[model samples]
Target: MAYQQQQHYQTQQPMPTMGMQVGGGNRNAAGKPLDSNGKREWSHGLCGCFEECGTCCYACWCPCIVHGKNKQRINHLAAKGSPDPDGGACCSGSCWGHCLLTSFLGAGWILQCINRGETRGRYGIEGGGCGDCCTSLCCHSCDLVQVSREIELEEKSFGQRY
Candidate 1:
């Protein structure tokens, strides 16, 4: 019996590269593209708070209202879908509870500080001016006003852009 020798050749194929995009091109938490103008990407300078009289007044008198509104917006943006049924209640309760609790005891800046930290964490903002708590403690109203402005502007920009 004679066995015939057979040779098999293997063909090489190039592997496909992932080609993942970097920097994600400035996407929001919901994976949506932010406005190219970048108007809503970051907070305005804290010193500019007085330039917007309306925001300053609102933040001054009823920080809870501003904070609650900002919180709601942030939550909404993060959710990026049907609004949460308990969104209003949760925001109201948390804002009121924290604001009242912090204020009555002369520590009103605490909540703002925490919220500032949260904003920074969400938006990838760098901390500045002796840390969140100190910055908020020193410029509590400005912080609240600035945060409110940022979220409001961002939501509006989102609507306009998409």
Candidate 2:
């Protein structure tokens, strides 16, 4: 009796690559194309607070409120489908949290740094975590103003009034 040899075949799945393009070119979180270096620059500089006097004043006088609004706007932009029911309320829980942290622990810079990092990630801005923390710690109000301006500009580009 002759026995036939049997062979088992295995299929290899392709591994997912980093920065994979879905349609055409590499796009950031806001659906904008990346530069040749694969990163985007901030719409406004950190020291450009005076560019929007109202925003600067708002950020200076009521930073927590501005933080809340900026957080809400970033969340809305990231979600990109339904509008936030809170409508980016300035007195949201985040505002209270920031106020409490700043008033009590003097640690609001931690939260601000996190939000700054998030904003950078969402817009694909070029920066490092260290820089974000430093900016939030040293230039807190400026960072808030910059992030707010960036979000507002993004919203305007998308034809949405902030």
lDDT for each of the candidates?
0.62, 0.76
Task: Return the TM-score for each candidate structure.
Answer: 0.63, 0.75
Model 1 C-alpha lDDT versus the unseen true structure: 0.62
Which digits, one per residue and each the tens of the lDDT, describe model 1 over residues 38-119?
2233557888789889869877787677667667756766666323234333357657866776667867677777778777
Off by over 4 Å in 2: 1-36, 82-87
By lDDT, the best candidate is 2
Clashing pairs in 2: none
Model 2 weakest 10-residue run by lDDT: 21-30
Q: Estimate the Cα RMSD of every predicted model relative to the unseen true structure.
A: 8.9, 5.7
Candidate 2 lDDT over 31-63, as tens digits, reads 445577666777677899988898789888888
